[model samples]
Target: MFAPTFNLNLTLRRAVLAALLAAGSSVAMADPLHYHVEIDTSQFSGAGFLDFAFLAGNSPAPGATATLSQFSGAFGALDSKEGNVSGSAPGTLVFGNGGGYNDWFQNVSLGGRFAFDIVFGGDFLGTNGNVGTTFSLGLLDQSASAYLGNPNGNLLQFDLMPLNGALPASIAASTYASIASISAVPEASEWMMLTGGLALIGFALRRRRVAALTA
Candidate 1:
């Protein structure tokens, strides 16, 4: 006599639950930290080539800063300009830093003008100087373009001058360095949602199976 096959639905249920739990355990809203870089040149190319690194457990909060090793460009020169820095819109398909932060690090349209705000704790120009330059970085325009990949948004651009009207003494030095190194941890809520969804699916499936058997 031939043996009967065992039910396969139970195994499927367990596998689905496991996957949902895994996904749910890793959901957290990324906190955003902003760092602005001043572009030195009127126009340049390959600004995105700068090496970026992020460490784990870094808070996306104010007073947190990132240190860049160096700034290099494809044109063999530090093709950056001086301008006040803040961050772009976070978590967007266009002009976003791939992760959960809002920095204008990607998809910049050259020769286009935009405005931004910068908040400094003290004198960014120097420690001894008291040139309280606290205002919006006005006329913040992309004076030039460099690359042609990832559409018009992925192109990078910068300011022709730090403040536009006049050059600040801090133009030579970067007001904000590239904090390319940071990381974010997942929150507990994600896991709960995933588990909850899986449980509901399992219950519905089991009920259907029972109904079928009775019918």
Candidate 2:
């Protein structure tokens, strides 16, 4: 009777460990997402200041908001916008310039309408180049002014999402269109750690069982 109970307990423990391993692995994976973040800043113009900017690297908590980071130091990704959609103006947009990053309304305004495309990439070179599966996008307000100014101040934010879901949109009063996105997955190192732990546990259990049999 004692031997039977001991065997049953060992079996139960092994089953529990396997279940936990499976659960942990599943929770850590969620394929990275791709996105198309389109915005309409036509109603306004940021002539002297950047109307928007974004932090690139993936973060620990990637929900529904653009994570904030400095312009110079970071890695994994780099947030950037394409050319001016304002009808006529070449090479007007500045990226990580004058020291790091910059942009303006003139770069995105088109006659009376403004539109631009930006890949909300983060600079992943600092102390944290860690990557995840989701993206954080941020829109600029003004150079302490709006409706039309040199620079934008306030930051409108969004989390974005899974690759196949719906694209997120933005703009305080204007319009926006999106197409879900992300870039995060569990590291190989984490898997190695898990494997090591399981091996040790199993070895210890086996030794205990042998000692019991000998006694």
Say which candidate scores most in lDDT: 2
Off by over 4 Å in 1: 1-48, 51-145, 148-188
* lDDT tens readout by residue for model 2, 1-215: 13454664676577557646643653432312122233333544433223443222233313222322222111112223442222222322223311122223332312232223333322221112223222223333334244332123232333333223232222112123222122233346555656765765676567667666966
RMSD values, in order shown: 16.3, 15.3
Worst 10 residues of 2 by lDDT: 69-78
Q: After superposition, how far is residue 83 of candidate 2 from its true place, in Å?
A: 7.6
lDDT of 1 by residue, 19-124 (tens): 5765644321112112243333234322232211211122221121232222222222222322222322221111211233322233333322222222122222
Displacement of the residue 97 alpha carbon in candidate 2, Å: 10
